[model samples]
Structures are given as structure tokens and as C-alpha cells.
Target: MSARSQRPGFGWAAPATVFFVAFGILPIAIVAYLSLTRWNGLGSPEWAGLENWRALPDDPDALNGIKVTFLLTLLCWLIQTPVSLLLGVWSAGRQRSRAILSTVFFLPLLLSTTAIALTWLSFLDPNFGLAASLGGSSLLSSPHQALYAVAFVIAWQFVPFHTLLYQAAARQIPTSMYEDAELAGANTLRQFFAITLPQLRNTIIASSVLIVVGSLTYFESILLLTGGGPGTATRVLPLHMYIKGFVGFDMGFASALAVLLVAVGTLLSVLIVRSTGYYRMASDREGFL
Candidate 1:
């Protein structure tokens, strides 16, 4: 083909490419630029060199927020991912069962974060909530337990989404593989480890990426639940940024925190992509048994 004729279609791609460059790339570049300056969202922005990065280490609130953010992220991932996958596998094992169970699992994702938070507020009410009504202590009212309460709510809310993802991935496994494994005298557990799990590795990794990022950045659930209160026990980075920017009106430092958030999120996504072999051209079915 002639070089001129070899050009690809730009009809739909052009607009999307432009949109990304304008809204996504440009904004990220601007944020990177702003991160190095001392602009309080007014007047001229003064150059601050590495001051923000330097301050990040010593800022107690930022440090705490980072700790809380990672803690919450880790808890959600460690607990939710496996549960979702197992549920998905169990649900997908049968057609009718899958429909009913999947619906129940996914119901939480349909509710607004605020609505979910408020609903949990009542459930976790120390005085008269369902917890107390059921003769159990309300998890929300206890500072020692509030973080776990929020984490539980978050995991409960997102489990269905992950379950659905895993279900879809699991359903793609050829029945022949299961039959072959069974013929080899492999039991369910053996088939799962040697056959099923390895097949779903990519989907599992992809789902995990979504879960981790969602848990890290999503604060509405935690915000309404505890407002990062009980003495900053749950003041995650996003909450800290909100308090600093809007409550404290220190736009410069807030923006710096925002930049830090973006940096951390970006780094996390990159790490997941790298560790999961997600960015490569490998097919999802490449390693399947």
C-alpha cells in the first residue's frame, strides 16, 4: 500500500484522542507544574522546588492519611478479592443459582454511597441500631472498631461487582477442561488450584486493580460513616485533602496533597499493571489448562 493510503481511520478516534489530550493529559501536566509551586489558587505562583515533597514526610496529617489510605486499601483487597472470587465461582457453577445469588450480591452497588453510608449509620447506631437491636455492640460507635466497620461496608458494597467480574471470567472456562481434570482423578480442590485458578489469573488481577483503586480513592462511604473523626482515626488522604482545601482554605498545600494523591494513585496503577503482566500483549487464555 502507498504510504499515504496506509494511514488509519481517524473518524471516531480523532475526537477521543483530542478529548484525552485536552482533558486528561493537559490536566495532569498542569497538576505536575502546580505541584512545584506555592500557589494558593490566587496571585502569582511562587516556585517551591522540592518543598512539597520534603514537607510530605514531616506532615503528620498527610502521613496519617497515607497510613489510613493504605491500611484501608490493604484490608479491602485482602478480604474482598478472594471472597468475591470464591462467591463468583460458586455462583457461576449453576445457572439458576448464579442469577439469584449474583443479584443479591450486586444489590449494594446499586445504592448511592451516601444512601449506603446512611443505612449503615442506622445499622451501626450504638444506641438503637440493628446491631444494638440484635444484642450486639454497634461497630460504628467504637473508635477501635469504626475503621473495620467502614471497611466491612466498603467490602460488602463492592463484592458484588467483583463477583460479577469473576463469574463472567469463570464461565468462560471450557467444560472440557473440568472433565479432563476429573478424568485424571483430580478432585474439586485439585481442579481449582491446577485448572480453574490459573485460567482466571488475568481477570482476577484486573478485578483486583479495580478494587484497590476504588477502595483507595472512594471516601464518601467513610466520610458519612465517621467523617474521619474519633480523632483523625480514619482521616484518609482524600478526606485530609478535602479538609485542607475547603475547610482550612490552604489551597496551596491542599493542591500539593492532591498532587501527592495523583502521584500515589498513578504509582499504584503502574505497579499493578507491571506485576500482573496486564500491559503486555499476552492473551487472557494463554496459560489456561
Candidate 2:
């Protein structure tokens, strides 16, 4: 082969490569370094080796944060995925009602996260808020109810995005398949179970990866809604990291948590991709899974 032909296409990839190195690789390298040292964002970092990492196992608040983070991840998967799938399936058909319903379902995504959190915060406020009329304590003030309420808000905001994903995937299925299923004496529910769900497996897997990773990093809404209040009841890993780094002035420990969060998210994503046979199906363009 000619030298010219053997030359890699650096011209085409240079921009993206530069961006990845500058923004992605550089920040991660900094974080990795900071995770090994004690620095309170202002002073010179003092080398601490593995001290911060070792402390994670014995840290009660950190342990609780991990538990809460995983709980939120599971709750989001269970609640958002199914509901999004149903909405997507129902809206895949061209109907006026479906269009209206999809619009209503997606309206929440239009608002900012701060707005959504604050709105829910008001609704859950016991004094002069909507929940006041419910005649009991505010849900946000209750440790048991706070986490679930926050999870619901997160799911509500993102469900539309997931629904759009599934809707697009579902719509790509050939109409002939449904016709064949109808001719085979399949009912609507039977068709969905045999065909629609099967066809959407890859989409579901992909969406689940996004949701799981997002759940791990959810912070803003939680911060605004509950401030990880009611005594750490709703504090997730990201929120805990923020508190450690900024609020508590424990940057080293916070960096360790951040690294762990990234590691966990990456691990889960890889497992999902592999277990779902995503790599094997990647080259298939026919789209009929």
C-alpha cells in the first residue's frame, strides 16, 4: 500500500481527538491525581496515598449514599422504563389521541430541572403548598417518603426522552409483521408480547444503560428539592461527593467518590452492553431483533 493510503485519517479525527483529550482525558487525569491527595480546593494538595480510598469502606455516610444511589437507580429503572415503553408503544401508531397523549407525557421534559424540582418542592411543602391541603406532614420532610418523591421527579423529567427513543425504535418495525400477527389470530396484547417487546429489547437495553448511569449521577434535582435533608435520607453518591468536596472541604475523599461513581457507571454500562448482545447486533442494519 502507498504511504499516502497507509496514513491514518488524522485530518478527519483531529478535532474530536483534541476535544476528547482536552475536556475528557485532562479532567479525568486531574481528578485521579486529586483523589490521591488531600486538597480543600484552595491549598496545595497534600499526598495521602490510598487513605481516602480506604476510608470509604468504613464511612457510614458514604455507605448510606451508595445505598441510596443504587436504590434510586433501581427505582428509576422499574418505574421509568416500563412506563416509557408503554407510552412509546401506544404512541408508535399514528392517531390523534396518541399524539396528544405523547405531547402531554413529554411536557415535563420541556422545563428546567431547577423549575421541576422547585415546583415539586412547593407541591410537597406542608405550609401553604399543595400538600398542606392533604392534612399531614410534607412528603419532602419525611425521610421515608423523600427519596421516593425525588426519584419520581427525576423519572418524570427523563421518561419523555426514553419514550422518544422507544417510539422511534418501535416505529421502525415493518407494518407487515403486525399484519402477519393479526392474520395468525393474535390479539393486541399477544402481538405486543410476542413482537413489540421482542423487537424493543435492544432499545430497552440501551435506554436502561442511560437511566442507570444517569441515576448514579443525579444531584441537582435532589439538591434543590431536599438538599439531601431530613438527615441524609435522600443523599446519593453524587450529592455526597458534592458535600464532601465543597461543603465539608474534603476534596480528596470527594474525588475518590467521584472516581468510584465513574467506575461503577462504566462497569454497569459495559455489563449491560455485553449481556444484551449489543455488540453482536451492532452490525445488523435490518433492525429486526
Candidate 3:
């Protein structure tokens, strides 16, 4: 073959390559470099070796932020996934019901995060709001209740997105399989276990990865709704990072935290993908490597 023909599609891949280099590779490289220094977002950065990284374990705020982040992730997963799956299954079974309910469920997703947070804030207000009649205690002000309340709102906004994903995946399942199960006198629950769940495995994995990664990086809504307070009760890692970088002006420490956040997110994504055997499934179906 000619040298030109044997070469890869460099011309076609140029834009994507440039974008990845500029946005992805460059930022990660910069953050990794910055993590090892002590800079206050002014003057020159002084080399601090691994001091910031070492301090992370001992830092109460960082530790609490990690705990809160994971807790929020767990709550979001528990609240959103099953409900989305159930709604997806239900909607898939009834076309007419699907149209109406899908619209209602997805409406929240169309609104901006700020708008959703503001709306929920009003609803949860202690006076003259919907929660006022329920003993009139402010949910957002109580440290114990604040995290869960914020998590619920986040879940409410995202559940429909997952539901739609599951619905699409469910629709891809062959109808004949369900018919065969029915012919054998299988009920809805039995058929679901035998057919639907197994077929939707890949979809579930994809949705879960998205949810976990998103949960880890949650910021804007939490910032607007709770401001990571009632004494740092709902302060997640991203919020902590923002406070450290912008508010405290500890650029280097925040960069270290940022790097750690990226590491944790990447590790979680990899572990979930591996455990779910997503790559193997993809390779089997599409000959992907």
C-alpha cells in the first residue's frame, strides 16, 4: 500500500485531536503540575512537594467533604436508580401512559438547575411554603435534614433523564421474547426478571456510571440551595474545592483537591465499568477493543 494510504485518518481526526489536547490534556496536565505547589492565586507558586496531598488526610474539612460527597452519591443512587427503572418499565408497558407520564417526569429536567433549586428552596421554606404545614421546621436549616433534602431535589431533577435512558433500552428488547415468556404462562414479575433485567444490563451500567460521575461533581445546585452549610453539613467535595480555591485563596491546595477529585472520579468510573463488564459486553456485540 502507498504510504499516504497506510497512514491513519489524521486529516479527519484533526479537530477532535486539537480539542482533546487543548481542553482535556492541557487542563489535566496543568492541574497535576499545580497540585505540588503552594500558590495563593497571586505571585509565583512555591514548590511544596506532596505537602498538600499529605495534609488532605488530616484536614477535617476535606475529610468531611469526602464523607458528604459519598453520602450524597449513595442517596442519589438509591433514590434515583430504582425509581427510574420502575418508571421506565411501567412506561414501556403502556404507550399512552408513557407519553403523558414521560412529559410530566421530564419537565423538571428542562428547567435550569438554578431555577429548580430556587423553586425547591421556596417550597421548603419554613413559613408560607408547602412544608410549613408539616410542623413548620425549615428542612434546609437543619444539618441532619439538609443533605437529604438537597439530595432529594437533585434526584428529582435527574430521575427522569435515567428513566428515559432505561425506556429507550427497554424498547430495544425484542417483543417476541416477552411473547414467548407469556406463552409459557409467565407473569409480569417473572418475565421482567427472566428477560427485561438481563437485557437492560448494559444500559444499567451506562446509566450508573453517568450517575456516579455526576454525583461526584455536583456543585451549582448545592451551592445555590444550601451553600454547603448549617455548619458544613452538606458541603461536598466540589463545593469544598471552590471554597478553598476562591474563598480561601489557597490555589495550590485547591488544585491538589481538584486533582484528587479527578482521580477519585476516574477510579470510580473505571471500577464500575470493570465490575459491570461493560467493555467485554461492548467487545462481544460490536467487536470494540
Candidate 4:
């Protein structure tokens, strides 16, 4: 007689599980199998065993990619978190101005990643873009600035998404907590740290995990913008893998790199969830129930 009992059984989940297996597990398995063999999409895959994995240690681009990947992740976190958090918090206010401004702020989320990257690429074009107006200097082509340029663009494309996350999370925080803090002589800044920060803790952890993991897979934007150029200054792991796989036709080595990236992304996610106690945190709604 219970409503829970009326719900369909595991049959409803079958479609999702099938889709995941077909798209997710299947490709990973194919890639794992390819990692042990040499192929250039010319003929049948030849068995190369651990040759590709062994070569990773000696590959200069792979090493540089690891370094650059970490650096980008750090920069992205440094840039996106504070800005998104502040914007999200400010927008959570029930005001017409905040609503209108937040709508404009989140408009970037409507654009595709490729569109954003290409648009910025034009702006950074040395000959006729925004750079031409400034000093004919292109950040995308600068050895010292290309990485930062890429980071800025990445932030520009994704900050709206993460800000949406924070905004929703901030809204879920009880308003009564702030009212109580105000009654206790706590100023606005004091209330934020005591009430807002603590409440948004889980959202922050979830967003950080997403940002860090997503940083590992940012190939298209970098490809469209810098092409990992300016003397390998912006070639992260995914881009390097892409070059080896698609550009050089070295499928075997590329598969190995892909496996390594998958492993790292998985491990990093696990570590963050465990360390932050995010998995153990319970929902406020569940407490009410």
C-alpha cells in the first residue's frame, strides 16, 4: 500500500545502465585493449604489450603535460572558486537588480564550448582582433602567457556553470540562520563566514571535484585556441594524448595516455570525496524526514 512499493523496480534503471555501458564502459574497454597494442587506424591492431606504458616515462611531452595539467587545475580553482562563490552568493539575494544581473552573468552558459573558444581566439588574434587594437600582441602565441590565456578562457566558459551550482546551493541555506546571526550582533562578513561558508561546504567540494576532474579533459578549447603551441607551453595531458592519437596516428601510445588520465581522474575524485567527507554528508531534507 506504500507509495514506495508502487514505484517500478530495477527495470527503470536498465535503460540508463545500458546506455552507460554502451557509451562509457565499452569505449574504456576498447581503449584499454588498444593501450596494449600498436595501431595507426591503418590495419588490424598489433600486440605491443606494455611498450606504450613503458614509453610514457621517457616521453617529454607526457611529462610536461602532467605538470601543465596540474598547474592549469590549480589556476582554474584559484580563479573560478572565489569569483563563482561571490557571484553565486550575491545573486542568491531576492532583488530585481540581482536577478537581472545574474541572468546576464549566466548567459555564457548558453553558448557552446567551441563557440566560446573560437570567439575568444578571434579576440586574441594578433592581426585583427582585440590584440590588434592594443599592441598587436597575442596571448595565445606567447610562451609566458598562453597557458594563462587558456586558463582565462576556460574560466570564462565554465565560471557561469559553477556559479549556477553555488547559487542553487546558497539558496538552499536557511534564511533563519542569517536572521539569528544578525540578532547576535554578527556583521554581514561575520554572518557569511559563520553561516554561508559552512552551509556551502558540500557544494564547494562537489564543484572543486568537477573543476579538477574536468580540467584533465580540456582538449577542444586548447586545440581551437592555441593548438598546444607557443613551444608546448599549453599542452596538457589530454591535448598531448590527442596529438599522439589523432595527429601522429600513434594510437597505441595515445591509448596508454588515455588510460593514465582515466586512472588519475578516478583516483583524484575518490581522494577528494574521502578527504572532504562529502560522501558521508546527509541531506537536510533527509533529516527532516
Candidate 5:
């Protein structure tokens, strides 16, 4: 048979499209409808008719949630990308010790998120955790320090995953490129800047999109760690939405926040992809091939 004759048809996408509509698009549609009605997780939803949407402009917590979410997202990118890049490049070396150490470094990604959060929660406990043992003032209880602490813990948890991405991408850089640079008397640092970073451009953009969008749903760690506590210092959008919907029983407003969350995450991912031309999956070696 001709290659074209055996190619998958449009029918191949039906299962995935149906699944996305049922679970993904359908949930968003329901939430959008819920945002227009006042539901308290009890009786039938009353027609709120933009009351929740209008209040979003004046809601202190919602606004702060947006700010904090972006702040954390930025922090994650700043903390993870460079560290991951450095470690990934280093670990890409074909050495026994590098492989062994890379395995250890990736342990965090293997652990359960709840277990990791709870472990950190205990470590940061003011009374008896490691933070107290260090004789430093309680990090988690201090509003000024808690957010930064959370960001650090987030980096600790997620950096390994991104590092793995960079490692794979780094290893794929044609050895000849580095050899050519070496022939030209380029130093390690110069070769990295000129070759590694440029070739990994696509991976960086892809990883960044994941980090920004994933930051929106960072509910469990913050929930388990601070419970949006120390007076809303670490209360990100997801936790803020949870408090409104479940704790405050303002489901309609929370639905609005969820819609906002969806909009912001989608926009951010789309913007990055569009701006960087990542959607084309452009190769750094386009002409080098």
C-alpha cells in the first residue's frame, strides 16, 4: 500500500476530541454557566446575572491572588530555569559519577507531592521542625518570609523535572558543534552561551509554558503548607478560589475566579507559543541539517 493510503484518517482524532469535550471543554462551559448564578453548594443556583463578575473588580482577595500567582510563577521560572540549565548541562556529560548524581537529584520528582509538602511543612514548623532547630525565626509564620519560602520549596520540588528536560536536550546537541567550537578555541562558558542555550531555545520555551500554566493550579502544596495562612501572604489564585467556593460557600464567585484562571493560563501559554514561534517547532539546526 502507498504510504498515504495507510495514514490515519480524521476518524482517529474522534476519541481524543470526544474525551476533551467531555472532561475538559465541558467542565469549563459548566463553570462559565455557574459563574452567572449564585450557588452555595446547596440549593439550586439563583440567577446572579453578572453580580459575581462585577464584584471581581473590587474584590481584594481576587486581585491579590492574581498578583501573588504571577509573582510565584515568575519566581519559579527564575529559580528553576537557570539552576536546571546549569545542572542539566553538567549532567549531560558521559560520566559514571554524573549519572549517579543525576539519579539522586531526580528523587524529588519521584516522591508524592502531598508527602513532599507535608515533609516541608514539618520541616518549617516553628515549634519542633528543622527550621526551629536551626535557631532561625519561624519562616512559615512570618508573612514576609513565607511566600519566598514557598517559592523555594516549589523550586526544590519541580527543578528536577525541568533539569531532566534540559539534560535530554543538552545531550542531543550534536557533539560536532562543541567539537567545532573547541577547535575554534572557545571556552566552556562561551560554547554554552553560543551553542547550548541557542539549541535549547525550544525546550526553554516549552518548559516555561509548563511552569507558568502549572503555577495556576499549585493548590495542594500551598494548602498543605500555609493553608493560605499567615494572613493571605501565600494565598494564590487557586487557593483563593478554593476558599471562596468551599470555605466561604460562594461557589458562583469561585466559578468566576476559575474562569479567570483558565483565561489567564490559556492566554499566557498562547502568548508564549505565539511570540516565540514555538508552535512551529522550529529547529535550531534547520539549515545545519
Candidate 6:
């Protein structure tokens, strides 16, 4: 048969491609051009050479922001993933509990980030707050622990999403695998390792990537919690860029920070996909043995 006959028309794909180019590719090009220039968010963007990038390291607060951003991303993902997986597997096996637990976990995600941030801000406040009511010190005041507070809030918001993804993957597994495991006298733990996990590899990888992206881009949540901190302690890259661009009125520098944030996010996404063997799992119909 002819190639034209075999490979059909654009149809729906054409619109999607157009959308991608219009919204994605075009914006990226604009941002790329803006990053290399000095702009006040107004007049012409004058080429500033590598001035913005070179100044990044010397900006003490910005450097600290970058460090905290990476730390928070790692902490949130590490803590959230395993809990989500275990709960996902358990809840997927039960109907009523799954429904109730999924609702509970997803409720926070349904709320606006600004609302969640405000709620968390009060909860972590030193006075007249839930944390204080629980006889705990003010999380917002404690620079050492402020980032963890942000992580906790984010985890609480997103764990349900990860669990739902995991459950969906778990439910797709064949019942014969569980039956065979029982027949072989393999305990629940062994059965999970041998059957469930291997099958859920793709789901796990996908969930991790999603979580990483969420943690990286989180702004309002962190902003409200501590306003980037008592002393810039919890200022992450997004917050940093916001402050520099809007608050500091340094559009060029802000764009540079934005570029770095995107670069880091892209790099982490690549690493997560490769490390989790997402590609291999996707191509395999039966999952890993």
C-alpha cells in the first residue's frame, strides 16, 4: 500500500500540534530570547551578554533559594512516593475503603493552592494556630524546619493523587497472578514484590515524575506558608524568580532564573524516566517479570 494511504490525515492531531506550537514552542522561544536581554518588563530588551547568568551565583539569597528548592523537591518526592504506593495498593484491593480514602486524600488537591497555603500558614503560625494548639513550636518561625513544613503541606495535598494512580495500575493486574502466588505459598510481601510491584513499575514511574514536577513548580503553597521565610530560608526557585521579577523589578534576572528552573525540571524529569525504566515498561504489554 502507499505511504499516504497507510498514514492517515492530521485530523485531531493537527489541532493538538497547533496548540503545542502556539502555546508551548512559541512561548519557549520568547522566554529564551528574553532571558538573554535586560528588560524592565517594558522597554526594548537590550542584550546583556551573560550578565544575568553570571550574577546568579553572587546573589546570596538567590543561591540559597536554588539550594532550598532542590532540597524540598527531593524531600517531598522521597516521602510521598512510597506512602502513596503502599496505600494505593491496599486501597485498590478494597472498595469502600478505597472510595473513602481516595476522597480524603484528593480533597486537599481540589482546593486552590492559595487557599491551601493560607490554611497551612495559619496552622503553622506560632500563635493561635493548630501547630501551637498541638503544643508544637511555630514551624514558620523555625528556619531549620520551615522547608519541611512546606513539604508536609505539599505531601498532604498530593499523596492522594499518587495513590489513585497507583490503585488504577494495581487494579489492572490479572487475578491469576495473585491466585498463583497463593497456591505457591508465597506470602503477601513476596507476592507484592514478585507480582504487584513489577507490574506497577510504569505507574510508579509516572507518579514519581508527576510528583517531582509538582514539587518543583510549587509557589503559592510555599509562599503562603512562610513568605519565603524568616530570612529567605525557604525561598525556592519559583519564589525567587517571582520576587526578582515582580518584587525586585528585575525582569531579565527573573527570566534567567525561570530558565534555570525549567532546565532543572527538564533534567530531573529525564532522570526519573530513565531511572524508573518508564520507556521499557510502556513498551511491554505484560510488565516486568
- Predict model 5's lDDT versus the native: 0.92
Clashing pairs in 5: none
Tell me which residue pairs clash in candidate 1.
none
Compared with the true structure, all predictions reach lDDT values of 0.83, 0.90, 0.89, 0.91, 0.92, 0.84
Clashes of each: 0, 0, 0, 0, 0, 0
Q: Candidate 2: deviation at residue 101, Å?
A: 2.5
lDDT of 5 by residue, 151-189 (tens): 988999999999999999999999998888899999999
Candidate 1: C-alpha RMSD after superposition? 3.5
Off by over 4 Å in 1: 1-12, 36-54, 284-288
lDDT of 1 by residue, 211-257 (tens): 78887787888889999977788888999988876787666677778
- Stretch of 10 with least lDDT, candidate 1: 280-289
Alpha carbon deviation, residue 174, candidate 5 (Å): 0.7
lDDT string for model 6 (1-289, tens) is 2455777678959989999999988887787777888998787889998899899899998889878988998998898999999988888876786687677766876888788888888877788889889987887798898888888988888887788898888899888878878998999999999998888878877888888887788898877788898789899989989998999888889988888888888899999888777765444435344
Candidate 1 vs candidate 2: which has greater TM-score?
2
> What lDDT score is found at residue 261 in candidate 5?
95
Clashing pairs in 6: none
TM-score of each predicted structure versus truth: 0.88, 0.93, 0.91, 0.93, 0.95, 0.91
lDDT at 266, model 1? 85
Candidate 2, residue 75: Cα displacement in angstroms equals 0.3
Best by TM-score: 5
The predicted structure with the larger TM-score, 1 or 6, is 6
By the TM-score metric, which is better: model 1 or model 5?
A: 5
Q: Report model 6's TM-score to 2 decimal places.
A: 0.91
Q: How would you encode candidate 3's per-residue C-alpha lDDT over 40-60 as one tens digit per residue?
A: 988999999999889889889
Q: Mind giving the per-residue lDDT tens digits that candidate 2 earns over 134-168? A: 88678888999998899898988999999999999
